[model samples]
Target: MAQHVERQRYWEAQQAARQAERLARKRARSIDWSAALRPVEPVPIRTETLIAALASGLIAALLLGDGVGPGLLIAAVPAVAAAYVAARAAGRRPRPWTLVWGVGSLALLVVPALRESAWPSTLAILAAIGLGALALFGSRTWPGVLLSPLGLLEAAPTGVRWAWQGVRARRTGNARNVWPVVKAAGVGIALLVVFGALFASADAAFADVLGGVVPDVSVSDGPVRVALFVLGVVVALAAARAAGAPLRWDRVTVAPGTPRSPVEWALPLVLLNLLFAGFIGVQLAVLFGGYGNVKERTGLLPAEYARQGFWQLLWATVLTLVVIALALRWAPRSGPRDRRLVRGVLGALCLLTLVVVASAVRRMDFYVHAFGLTRLRVSVVTMELWLGVVIVLIIAAGVFGARWLPRAVMASAGATVLALGLLSPDGMVAESNVGRYTEQGKIDLAYFQSLSADAVPALDRLPEPLRSCALRGINDDLADEGEVPWYGMSLGDRRAREILRERPVKASFETCAGLGTFRSRSEY
Candidate 1:
């Protein structure tokens, strides 16, 4: 009896030790990032890098040619990133991630230039660039992009320390000796203010004349603007550094589990699979019965028929992915049999989801074919296409977990964005609408009038009545071309200028919102 008791105690102690070890591992995996930011490294800044960074920022500011349009700001991303790369301490050949970032970042900047430099276009382009930068410089993945911001706190202190160290080293004086310089600056400021006020009081004409002076030549505002421009560039470069070279964060990988009953994940997945199959079967039936039957059965119009179930199917496709991922990550397995059953069920679900994806794509195509392609419609089409590719990849990964999957996906996404950039989506949209208008006499002049310069040449291909009004609208948009300097140039503006220069069409400038009008409506 004593022997048995001793053996039981030993087993219990062993289990306790295992539990403690697991807890220790968990604790080790999780870190208080806030605490470990100590002894942070100084931000690197070489003379060449500083010059490159400043030049890139200046180029961007200059490209703001029309005074800071979204296109110039966004397109500046790649230029800025290129500057960062030139400046980074590492002189080794660029990594794959960095190259992807470079391509994607530049593409993001050019997208706005290719399309209308609307606020939406600006936001989307910047977001894409930011994501690429985060992944490339920091985590090399989507989640890492999200966590990259937390790295700022560490960078902040280090940057300050580095700056302070530089000042201390350069000054060759006691730390407290800054008082003399501060006093001199304060006295100088007081003298300037006193003299300036007296001068203004003595001569009202002088003050009024100074106030009327152009900002470009204003003595008082020039120095301040220069200072502000320099400050802005510094901040931008600093942000790039923080994002690219952030301190490492703790990463925890879940441990593999022992064999267990299949009941945990099997039954639920089977039910889900059956539900997906039934849904897919219904979709197939509807697809086969034709749009007419769907229209009759659902009491929906042709337009409604095409639009119907799109959002639902999109959500379903996304949900299935999440479900499959969860099952793979957390599902209890009763060895190989349970694993196979789960994989088969998930695979079945994925295949069914592919049908849903197809249905969504078909609906989008029908809608675009009927309504003519808009930016939103084309974007959705692209999204659905990407989803289809993703589903196929997921299926393949399930069958065979290749280590190259993530890299392949990254490459494909980068390639797609680059291709889209080269293809010029705005130009394509214009081409599609013009073709549609050619076949059908119905053309929305106002909508066409609202399109960017890429559409102008396309609109020129239309018949006289449509062409006349459309050209008139475009001419009005470009009327202020003389006011904008060459530096603030845009593709749209350039194209419109070229066309106008070749054949100065006397377009009505009354109805169209000239490009300058957007400044009033700007959200920024």
Candidate 2:
């Protein structure tokens, strides 16, 4: 009897192992990895696309080669125009809304010419252009928006290939037609040189005018300029090709996570909702009872209390978003009861998270009010506000379904960045700090000195010593900007130069040394 029992136990264990092996094989077979690995077909290069790309490249090389300035707008115009022409030539109707984004992108490039602040304007410009590219040539879906930058990277090699193909086509198939155009251009140049030299020699005033009007061509930076031109050509080719035949990123689908039972999904979210609700209750008490009550109860100053929780609250809000995304992915979708549970639990969490977002904003507001506004403070506030907008969109998605959520979120982000650029954050910060100085009779002169040319107008409004001290650094910078070319000129730099010329700072460093504190603590 003992031997028979042992045999039966061994057989049962072997059968269980075989069953587990079968299940693993089934799971492996279900995933079609080759579908993702399949190569996409290359887009055909067209004559119109090639010509527009080369023109755009030439424009970029000419205008943007000097440096970042108003030339950014000048360079972008041709590239955008090329994309538009390429789309039309391909017999495709370009989306009208994409034109709006394109206009917004061009408008954002104007920021660098308007504001001297590097970070905010640069960030806004890059974001706007990236979103605009995605809107024009990639998917409007969430995944597509997220992956659009990668598409640009992949297109880099394709651009090189496109250029090679154009060269090859000219060499083999169109070789007979190339020499006539080259010969004609050479003859025209020869004639112009013979007549122009005679005219210049014949008239001294004409020579001087010609010399002033034409730029002095130099070979000192030849390699650098050539490299920039090549880079511009490659980038233009990539963009034009993308516009002609956009990748179908919207069709790319990610499999859903393994579904959980209703009890398994709901319990943790319900508990999380309770936790969020409890924290919100504490926030309410602090809000209604005033900081004085908090000081009395907790023995902490308003700024101290506000500072201690602001960073933590910001992280918490960020983590809560990740949690919601994961929860939605793993949610049970078996029945009406499961759907109701998800809507209730997730909706409650979203509402509570909004309160948390509000609390974070309020905390930052309190901190900013106490310490005065800086660039970092202003940037953080803007980011927090945008995050709040994202949460609201998520809630809307929960109700109306999420098909439109991704594009809407992307659009909102682009709009928010454009708004930030338009607001001229550096000027706003300077204005706010100047107002604070008026009220409190305290100022951070060193901090003002570190600001860009955008702050010059606001700082000019100060009294004698404060005004001279704040303007001293900016004056020196403007003085060094002796002769900016038309393409490299910025509105902020021009305005700053004008302001300094009207009323220059006469104070030396030693004179304004001990006038104001730096207020380094205002950073956090």
Candidate 3:
């Protein structure tokens, strides 16, 4: 018993010693102050970068402000200030961020100005720059960059120049690495090329599209317009440079996943480029020739506009989808199930829509033959209603039924194959024809005369060219067939009932309220 007790005591003492030693080691590790904090490396801010950022903003302001050159300066100040603040934090007394911000702001301003200069456009450019700056400064790797004066470096464009500079600087003990700069420059150049191609191609296409409408309107021969356009492009390029600074390369960096596949990373960009070119480049050319608003003046039917928009949208969608595919390539890896789940839901919804459409087709035959209902309008309405119902089903399926639907789709693939084969071709052709017809008949200025006063308000609220169209529709109808001829009246008289008359302008809110308070218009 004595021996056993002694042995037990020895084991207990050993355990206590072991525990004590562990604790001591842990304490020692905790108290090791040298390992607690990382050494702070100082970074110097470049003066040239600061100047560039501000200069960019200034140029943007000038371009956006139109002939009112001061607008550019006004717009550039905020960016300059931002740059300065950033530089101060980088242990440098320079203001490159401000300079770049100014430049970016200027670039943004110029593009809009070259298109159509206005306060709203200026505001939009400024807003974009501000948001971009916020995003750059808010990032995890460089939140301190925002606080640092050199944060503007984070805003530099990605390209050959940036890469070369980074390389040169790093080699000469001026920068850390040239890789980022190179990456930025390369991306920027790629995007520029893409955009340029889109612009050039779209511009050419516009010549064909606008051939029947405004054939005579030509580009301005004056150097001013050309200069403006050049300025706009330069500003855009500068802005692109600035914009390239904050890309999460880790997130967007491509990796070889599942080997090479049919879909590629460049596909999305291709789609995006095509869509942008089609919509914007085409539209610009059309506008330059003064036919951009022709649809409104031509009294184009609503169906026509919808059709035209459809073709454009279809191309746009294709482009967008391709671009999305490419973008997804660089996106962070996700589960296969998660990725496919969305498509599955969409397929289910489409199936549901097919069911609904089938039901409608059955009803149509009964209504047409048995009920002796043969009116074109009624037939059209019936078909539309059923189609609409199917569409709703598809949308619902996509939104809510995606997860399990894919599995079901695979299970019922055999049945679906037959139905889809039959339905796909006819439906696609009909839809396409309808789309084309609609575009061909799209509304323009001639129909403006037919709209009622009630419709005028909505039309007036539309963007410039379109609003003018709605107005024409309303006035034309009034002149030809309305009971009252209220032509030559100021804008206020048309809206007089809703507007108060206390202020000089009846539509002024203060005047309206004041007149209403006094009960003058109502009493009269």
Candidate 4:
């Protein structure tokens, strides 16, 4: 009986110990919601930091008021410089890679100064700024790069709060150095105004020169300028805070998906590889056999054949990437054999997808050759080329391991976009159409009318009524542009103005009326 009682006590003690451990684990796993929800304290603003932020805001308001052009780069300079200065002052040295990205971002602003097209310039600027933000505030991970834009949005409120804190501190007499600078600036401005006015009134030529040099400020632009100033201040403060204390996205861990058995993982991939292989074989046949073979087999014209499958093949390539990602996620990693299986199967899949990418690109090229290049054609071809690059990167990762894959992919994308901006898609399209017209005696003057000022030089090469019709819209736009400040003029805009000034479009409406209506039957 005593032995039974001891056993019962032992069992009870064991149960009690297990319960305590479970409780401890539960506590460990539970998040403190209140602490997470609490607002973060704003970093204290130094006098120099406040001054830099204000100056950046003022510069943005003045320069950016004219719109995106050289002024954009001019405004960005002070904002980026201020951020770097603030970071250094706070003892936070930026990484060399981050500085590289920052410089790239600044260089991207040149797109606006160089290109008149809205879409390309806008995309480049957004990408540039986003990359800069990611470098400064985001994690080094791929997901972090994508989500970094959210960090900028969140920083808006923080920036406002930081600016307000600075204002309050100044009101509380914490910034004694600021008052002296403000007084000195006021005195300097007053002296400049008095002397400048006297000199201007003293000479008519001097007055005219002064009027030409100074920008006209109107009350109507007050709201716009204020908004621009706020934007500049907010962006600068965000960069400063991010450089000082970046978000700890690197600390966020993603749990791997449940691992599958080797058979379960390998089977689907093997089938996919076989399918890709089959499609590639057919593509090879079509490629070597040429358009005659396509026409005979498909009973479709070369252009029709190209157009019919290009989009589908492009989607197939994209979906193949998605499939590869999923396969990687659930891939078996239990043993050496499984690892080798992964490498081999995924490697084959990537190789086959590259062929598919090539097929898609070829189809697009054939179509472009037949129908001439348009914006959509150029865009899709560029996308296909980038996808090919991504496939190559994936293959590299499979061989070398994937730790650097995400970053490499992002960098490649940025480089591709930068290249596209530099290449000038509109100019390329116009040039292609011109060449097609020269060879085939077929042109799409109406389509050319839709192009931006980037097309002017190429369109200027066209003969007679075609040239006049193609240039009409651009010429009208330039004519209405009036006298813009140099900062407001893009390279494309300036060049187009010069070209039109030298050889103006002189065709009447009646002459150009029926000219643009010529459309190829295969266009649809």
Candidate 5:
């Protein structure tokens, strides 16, 4: 009986091994490639590649066309089409040639309009759009360039590579139940607090610390305040992380039945906007009137007077209320209609800006002269251009919006503007002008004063090296009058006298000889 039992066990073991082998073979053979490799969605043509093709085509058409007029329109179609094809082929990983074609096509789109009338403001708008496109193109390789850190924080969680890995690991036995995420959050919060405190403290202490002295009370308080703020933010972030909430980009998705209709969203935003308008109106009213009070008391620029202490608090309160109202309106419960209302409000706001600009210009003549404010006779021309660009972006947000024609036109417009800015006279203005001069002590006073009244203060505050040169120029004028005529004086004194001697070329004066011995003389 024992032998028979042992035999049965041995047979069972062999059968089990054979069955395992068969199962492995079956599993290998049953592998489905389509299921494994299928994309989540169909790949669309890349916007940049299309843009490039359109640009190139536009150029070719324009060059080859019979006349300037016909060539532009005929060229645009081929350019846009070529771009579309190239973009589709390039998809996620585009070729250099693809980009080249797209860029070339885009140049064609704007060359005709721009060549016809070289408008600066129009060109600026086109330039901004082109920059945006270029940034979008670069995003394929270096995604961070187009995205802010805040954008990354929001969008990174939805991405397939990093987020998917984490998700899959959790699903499988390889990872624990969200415990690692919590741990990471906790650790990140702790590190943030520590680093923030250290940075704030070090910055506050830098000058004193180098000299081995303690910072003042205010400086010492910086680290403590910064640490508290960082701690609060980290704690909030940790709490959110613990809740397993998905990161938000900008939009808040809502459940279908939640009162997400448009009117709910619109009302609050509308009210808030009106409140903002009222606040602005009141402030301007005060400004217009405040001048009277200050003028009566003391003669000063209109910029000098204000109820700063109380008015600031009042403005803050008003702004805070407006923000809260807007936020309440923006919540998901307000729905799609709310978005439309917000858009309308935005448009109205733009209109208000135009009105304000017009009023301000009317009040200030120098502003109109300096900015060339009324060539178009329309307020917010630049703003309108920006609005158009924003509209294009909105259209492109839809899946089908990333097309050849628009992208190409946009790209061409951009390249044309860029070329113009670099190669034209206006570009000279952009290049020559610096924002402001802050290195006061390094500049020469007399030289600076000679340039403009603005530089007088800066020149007066100059450091030793440049100040000496300035003082010498001043002293030279003074010394030239007192010098004796007997063979003159030293080289410095003679030079001073000569400088004093210099008159306008129109004022003819004769100088025969100087110095008692080996005298030298020059024309005056």
Candidate 6:
């Protein structure tokens, strides 16, 4: 019986080992190790790429603007030019689509301008990001559109490899140039071994002279700067290469070409319509129910009553966009009446969403009036304005069967951003805040003090001691006239310096409390 039990245990152990071996074999089969062994082709450094690299570096060094006025407006020109040049390099004629790419580059250039305009950096950053994705992938259907620039991130390893190859080539070239010196040093080392020993043995003074000839360079921040320079070069080169050769549309596709069965779309959308209608009814009450009644009903503060609706409306707007996109992309071929019914429902939803947008804008206005102006408040107003435009476009598409709806929406958005870039954001903010202060006399001096040089001209419009004091404060802070290189020169800062130098703050420049926008938009 003991022998039989031992035999059973041995057989079980063997069975387990065999199972483990089989599992390992299965896992190995699942992987394509051929890719790991395959060599990735290097991105050849051509004349076009080299030119782009130089331009990118120069732009980075020069066109990087601060919270200076329309300095970004000026900086944006080169970026657009670069994109146009790059698009041309792709051996394509300057098509209208290439011009769209130019607009994207312009959008990037305006980020700083938008921030300097008076709204926060977040708005500008988001515009640049969205436009960047559009420029890269050329506004394909969903999922693929989202993956456009993110795909660049996925190629991080490839970028790193290209960068490494660049560095290696540079090092190899440098080594060739220094080879003679290295060879001479080897000979000198041999001579030193043959003669230095004799000289040191003959006289200790000769060894002392040799040691004195070698000067010790002290270690400091030099290495850190060198590392930063290297990092900048690598990053700029990578970005240049990518931008010059943007992702081809064919390479990134979304199959919105075919429609799904009508049955699959109809029921889901009908259910959505019921849900949205119920939500809209609530929104209607929120809009006209009066602030006090809503406050009492909800048991919230006046500010809370006002602040919460904008976000809800924003979500509704986004949801509407998603639904419309879904319907357009996947709804199957239907009879005329069914299609008409679907279109009618979608149109009603959009119209209702427009009402929601209006309510949101109203709530934001109430909140701002109650509290004060913030970047977020101002940015939301701008975004909602854009959302309203989108809804109008959607309605147009549905009503007129406009095939250009998507492109129009995108183009209009780009146009709006450029419009903002042209406007004085900082000046607008300052003007608004100053006007508010006049009405209520609630001034945040610290906030004003932190305002960029762009705000100086705006603050100049304020009356008396306030104007003089603010001007002096700004002048004193931006007092240091650092070495102004031709590159990295900020027009706004330069203007501030000039104004400070020219005016020197006389008591006479002060005026009455109320003043309209005194400077032209360009000057601000």
Which lDDT value does model 3 have at 417? 25
TM-score of 4: 0.89
The reply for model 5, stretches above 4 Å from the true place, is 1-271, 279-347, 356-524
Query: Which of the numbered candidates is closest to the native, going by highest lDDT?
Result: 4
Poorest stretch of ten by lDDT in candidate 6: 515-524
Across 397-456, the per-residue lDDT of candidate 2 in tens digits comes to: 989999878778877887888788778887898899899989987677878767788888
What lDDT is obtained when candidate 1 is compared to the true structure?
0.59
Clashes of 3: 69
User: Which residue pairs collide, candidate 4?
Assistant: none
Candidate 5 residues 175-241, lDDT tens each? 5645675689689979976776676677866534432321122454555545533333332222222
TM-scores for all candidates: the values are 0.69, 0.85, 0.23, 0.89, 0.27, 0.62
Candidate 6 — which residues are off by over 4 angstroms?
Answer: 1-45, 58-90, 107-126, 129-139, 151-240, 243-246, 249-305, 323-332, 399-409, 440-450, 468-491, 495-524
Judge candidate 3 at residue 81 and give its lDDT. Answer: 46
State model 4's lDDT: 0.79
Model 5, residue 99: displacement in angstroms?
12
Worst lDDT window (10 residues) for model 1? 515-524
lDDT of 6 by residue, 426-514 (tens): 65667777888889986544455545666676677777666765565466566654533323334555666676676666543334122
Given candidate 6, what's the lDDT at residue 384?
85
lDDT of 4 by residue, 1-524 (tens): 99999999999999999999999876765543223322244357666666677777887787677767787887777667766765676566767767667877887888888888887888788878777776776456766767666776766677667768778978787567677888998999899999999999999999988876665668999999899898888877777666555555554455789999989999988998998889889888885477788888778877888888999988988998999889988999989988899999999999999998888888887788788998888888888999999999999988888887866786777777778888888999899999999999998777776688898999999998789888997887777778666677789888988899899998888777777533332334
Give me the displacement of residue 181 in model 4, in angstroms.
0.7
What digit string (tens of lDDT, one per residue) describes model 3 on residues 1-524?
Answer: 99999999999999999999999997886555323311232233343443454445444433442233234444444444444443344443324543443344344433332221123234445444553453333322222222322333443333225434544666687444545766897899799767765665779775444432221213453355345444443433333333333233212112344532324433443454454445454434332233235355445533343334433333333343343334434533356754454354334434433433443343343332222222232334333443444345335544675333322322232222222222222223223323333455333333233323333433343343433433543343344432211212222223522321221111333432332322222100
RMSD of each: 9.5, 4.8, 22.4, 5.1, 26.4, 13.0
